[model samples]
Target: MTSTKDEISLAGRREWLGLAILALPALLASLELTVTHLALPSIAADLRPSGSELLWIVDIYAFLLAGSLVTMGALGDRIGRRRLLLGGAALYGVASVLAAYSVSPAMLIGTRALMGLAGSTLMPSVVALVASMFKDTRQRGVAIGIVVASVSGGTAIGPLVGGWLLDNFWWGSVFLAGVPVMAALLVAGPRLLPEYRAPGSKRLDPVSALLSMAAILPVVYGLKQIAADGFAWRWTGAIAVGLVLGAVFLRRQRRLADPMVDLALFASRVFSASAIALALAIFVLWGVNYAIAQFLQLAHGLDPLTAGLWTAPSAAGTIAGSLLAPRLAHRFPPGGVIAAGLVLAVAGFAVLTQVGPLGLLVTGSIVISAGLAPTMALATNLMIGAAPAERAGGAAAISATAPQLGGALGIALLGSLITAVYRDQFGHDAELTREALGSAAGADAFTTGFQVSAGVSAVLLLVTAAGAARFLPR
Candidate 1:
């Protein structure tokens, strides 16, 4: 491991305080991810976007964020982590204002893309800083847990905050929420976060960066289009082109003396398994979360605030799981704890399949979120730990990318399934308006959609649990 005098000392009080400051940006990044879900209807009403445009509004952020993560992480190593982070935060604040004031669908989408680009910088920087700050393994575990908790917690709380704002103000308020938080981070971050860069890191490859975006953007866009409109030549062509470009990207990385992505990292069984598991876990969590949020507001006919309040349990459960994970790992093997967490998610998904009342839905969400949180946290810890200390930024970027990809796939796959089921079950009914389908026959359609999605999610979680048991280090 490459070392410097800056990283030689064991962390003390200042380091911990710095962790708290770093969390603001991390929380800001994650909060933006989920906070827009409840506000979609409001935006649609005001902006009058088409169906495809509506989907793009949400998916674009994840698409760009996933595409840029590795490159930004590598950029952090070459430049400086804190420097990129602070710059990104400044840009994020401006993007938020543009998003909030957007008058057209195209403008909103463009601003969200900017937000995603800015977010890409923040995600890896803070995590890498944490890895640098707390050198002790046990302390790093807790510190990482806190950071993970901040992310999951932001997702859980996003709906409530967004809902409250929507109830009191306009949908634009959701995007505006980030302005002050980013400002706070800007103020506090420079004082707290220590800058770290990889020694002897090579100059970033512009071709690799372009190729990464080219590969990811088309694949994600194609997958989303496939879900919205059944297999078409354009969608298939996009996927094929993406795959070819991805192959070329991989080949170029192998040829580089200092690649943007080190091919050798995947060779470690621990890193690969943990990364895959993290992705799968997030895939299920985000998919289910998307379905539930719609179910609460559209089907159950709850106002935004009530829906937010009901959903709060899931975030609470995630926080509980994060705090409990390290202690559980001390008693049980890490793999076992992760497997147990998946099993809990399985139970939660099963509960949703029953199509019970709000109480049952809430209970299932709590259980599922609680189960998934520790799995994500512990798996991330493993991925970060498996890497060389100097490469922590890239490793953390990969870990962050898994969830972004999963969440995008989730919104595309599960959201499409819901639309398909809703149209099949109630689309022909003249009584239901397109937007008012929720008020008309929403319950039957949304519940059917939720049941279908939940059943699939449960099976995936079970299989993933077995994989966790078999592949992860015991």
Candidate 2:
């Protein structure tokens, strides 16, 4: 007969396998998915897809992912995370090939949307699997750190990987980046990863699934369009329709026995407050990164490769902060750590706005990232920790929604702010072509845009900080 300690050790090894399977795809998916943002000009020059088509190609993945995560995650509970993870991995690889060899922009964009569906299937399922696999809260906390690290820091790796491929090969090579990692995971996954099915899950609820998609797609699409096309009446109409649908969807979720997202979890003051802070942190996270990247490439004349290198400090800071989060949480409450992170992130943004030096921005970015980094792990853990084990997926579904909304809104709000500023400042400079305005509107317009975006990001950070302090438990 086996000793209790031996059984425990075997169980521990089995639990770790889930995180291993998760980390590779989570990292590659995030990195490859967004890495192409910088290569838009190159894509336009080669494939010549129209403006709207290009935006669709850029946004359709996020649109689909954000819309479908809750539904897919619920499905995973009914089926099994391990089985679906392997299936989703296969789908991701197939879609990557399609994206790499697309004959038309529409084909490429559609494939990307499918890839997003595959991603949503995989993301929450991985987290759910981790929770189920690791019976130990401490181990799961560390596992959560790994997940947050992949989500937060993956984009940092994105530029370097995408930049290198753009520098040497072709634009499509960015999609190819995920291929090798997927292949390795597929080979190792079956042997290493244990299969997981919820012990007492019911059949997936169709009504809840349909309402979720209906509610999220319109809002995300409208926000994205607003970012690219400005504040048009059509976009406003879509937003209004979406919000109404969302209200209806929420009512339905509250009444459901098995909701895709648990609406009731917001009752926890700590959970609600942390979610607020987490959402706002994401707003600054993407906004400043987007603004700063364009600024460095356009104003400083760095190649995509070198420009990516300059971002290393910020990435490192984010990863470091994520790693330190659990330890900090042990010493202080989740609220304190989150508020502290927001302060650092705000101070970092302040430094970036006033300072023009590249080295300084990098240093500030790193410092700021360190602060905001731990918030994700702590927030995610807190949300999941309080959830009924059966509703872990639902809690995650709710948690994930805020950040995706924040990201889309962040991009749109910041994009609108910068575009409005850029237009007001340079719209009358009759000689500057749209392309030239984007490319060579000189250092001042670019700096002004960067400063404005940074300032707004700072304000959001402060708001998140205050929200955390006022409401969250000490």
Best by lDDT: 1
Which tens-of-lDDT digit does each residue in 1-474 have in candidate 1?
646654565688889999998878767765776668777777877898876777789888878887888789889889998998899989989999999999999999999999888888887788778878887777787887898788777876788898899999998999998899889888988898899897789899999999989998888778766655556999999999999999999999999988888878888888988888888998888788777777887888777778778877788888889888988887888988999999999999999999658889999999998999888778888888899877677787787777767776777787777766665676444233245423424677768877988998899989999999988879
* TM-score of candidate 2 to 2 decimals: 0.90
- In order of listing, the candidates' clash counts read 0, 0
In terms of lDDT, model 2 sits at 0.73
**Using alpha carbons, what is the TM-score of model 1?**
0.94
Cα TM-score per model: 0.94, 0.90
Position 191, candidate 2: lDDT: 85
Residue 147's lDDT within candidate 2 is 79
lDDT of 2 by residue, 158-254 (tens): 8888888889988788888887877887888788777777657789888878887788777766765665455799988888888898898889878
